[model samples]
Target: MNTFSIKPTICFDTGSIEYLKNIKNKRVCIVTDPFMIKSGAADKITNIFKANKVEYEIFSEIKPDPTVQTVAAGVNKMRTFKPDVIIALGGGSSIDATKSIILFTVKILNASGDEYKKPLFIAIPTTSGTGSEVTSFSVITMGTTKFPLVDDKIIPDIAIIDADFVKTVPPQITADTAMDVLTHAIEAYVSTNNSDYTDALAEKAIKIVFEYLIKAYENGEDLEAREKLHNASCMAGMAFTNASLGINHSIAHTLGGNFHIPHGRANSILLPYVIKYNANLESGEETEAGKRYAKLSKILGLPCSSISEGVKSIIVAIKILMKTTNIPMNLKEVNIDKNDFLNKLESMVNDALNDKCTATNPIKPSKEELTQLFQEIYGE
Candidate 1:
């Protein structure tokens, strides 16, 4: 008895850059990053707006894992422009910044003296992962705290997916971000809160990750591979957005917040360990998340003699994939000292235990169990 909902406006193909010109808006704000501008995507989008005779402003200072300060800055810029539409163009960071920017704009209006509300928003995702275009959740970092802003107000009015944007993604980034998509799909499929709708999306996304991630990583110029990965990433995002995540996300968020580890890298390395930890639980337990993992393992072509063996194969495959991609398998190689983890062990466990995603874990571990898991990975 699960329930969910997703609704996004129609999107044109990669060649539909000219669609920007047809947008019937007086003032439009294009939110992006400096790298995107230098990559020529910003100019292309702005040129489209020009062709359409649309007046637009470009804000290109959004940073990775955007801070609350940065989001507020973008909001302020949005207000100054007072655009009828906000177009987000770039990777997850840029798309995520757009969500916060729009949310901040709504807050401003709710408190402002003016009765008029702000403009509509659209998302043009240049990256394949993060599915920020179709999701209602936005991750915003503030100081040392990571907060998720959940509201339908920020969901983009339209999502334009273009394979062209991912053509130049470096091999390492392709591997890293694709792993994030796989985690999203796998986590969503096993989520205690998952609905039938999300389960279907998760299964499809998992297969797509297996089939396209490596191809895209090995050959960034392959448009077909890029398109498939991009679609899979978006589907993964859609799935996770509806079902929410589990302990892997909980621990990853805390670790990334505290250690400055890349979000995908942290999840990719810890996913197998967490899955193994979860599979050790007794069946017919609080949540049968292990069943979903076993199914995913078979889908990924991992050996599965039984449910437990299937789970183990999935873990081994993940580790092997990370190795092939040159991603570090342990915290030690990522520049995090073992002593620092030992010192923070108690707090980190508590932080992850209390995380919003923790409650959904099929088999929630006690603080001691979490410590053991952290320590095992600390020295590796």
Candidate 2:
């Protein structure tokens, strides 16, 4: 049975952050990284709370990739403050860290047989990537290995997507994150669990990324492009959360976990190769995934004279976008020492296989195939 369960009512608009005004008389706990807190972005939310006379606490210990230790610390802090609402601000790291912190807190509370109530969770994304504001998944790191934690309990009660918050994002981050949106849509569309509900969302996200990702990257101040990309990111997140992801994400997870590469950059770099593998273009075979790629190519009005061409068109289009946005095309560009990558190959392979995302991939990859992909993506 196919099920479609999209949670969290999403609120968006140029001034949607003003929704915080509705949060009244509630003790709120704000979770975010040091950058947001230090750079005054957190004030965007805090100012509203202060104006409204709402009580709150700030947990600014969030880190990139959200380490386990940090989550425990956040939980410990929260246990004391015991806020009625929890708001995650900033990018995926902040949202992911907040989710993990909440998950563990609730689990610990329940295990101890103490009465506890899940806080009203609200996520406001400052970046147009990760779509984490709407998803129940969070990536928590332990000594460089990322563990993607998934549970419905972690889904936020509300998501605020204010394009205004994204205006100050750097061009490189805009490019990387928009590419992450594209990856999410494509992977979700081809996932074995994809249904009509998810396809509609994924297709829309793909179309938006193809049309406006560059616009957003070229000019961070582009209001229309920023709004569209933010919406696309959320759409892709909703699609993938229901359809599940694939090995592209699995491999990206390992790349981020083992090499400390940025998550979106890792995914974008491997995208074309993963697409070719999933579509079986090299083997001269038609696949369900290939047909979907052709459909997507047709949607994009790319020349899709055949399934293979359609699949190839996606790879080409993405490469062009990456190059235009100045994203590195290979590990060589990122300067990862080949020997270090080679030495870590087996472990990366093992992690990819074990990744929950790998279960829904259209193509089940072998160890040799994964090794080959790792080596190929390393580039000469």
| Alpha-carbon local distance difference test for all models | 0.80, 0.91
State the local distance difference test value for candidate 2.
Answer: 0.91
The TM-score values for the models, in the order shown, are: 0.94, 0.99
The candidate that wins on TM-score is: 2
Q: What would the per-residue lDDT of candidate 2 be over residues 184-299, giving only the tens digit for each residue?
A: 99999999999999999999999999999889888887899999999999999999999989998999998898888899999999999899888987777789999999999999
Q: 147-255, model 1: which lDDT tens digit per residue?
A: 6677777888788777877889899989888888888888888877887899899999888878888888889988888988888888887888788888888888778
Root-mean-square deviation of every model: 2.1, 0.9
Clashes of 2: 0
Off by over 4 Å in 1: 10-13, 281-287
Model 2: residues with Cα > 4 Å off, grouped in runs? none
For residue 57, model 2's alpha carbon misses the true position, in angstroms, by 0.4
Clashing residue pairs, backbone N/CA/C < 3 A, model 1: none
Instruction: Score residue 368 of candidate 2 by CA lDDT.
Output: 91
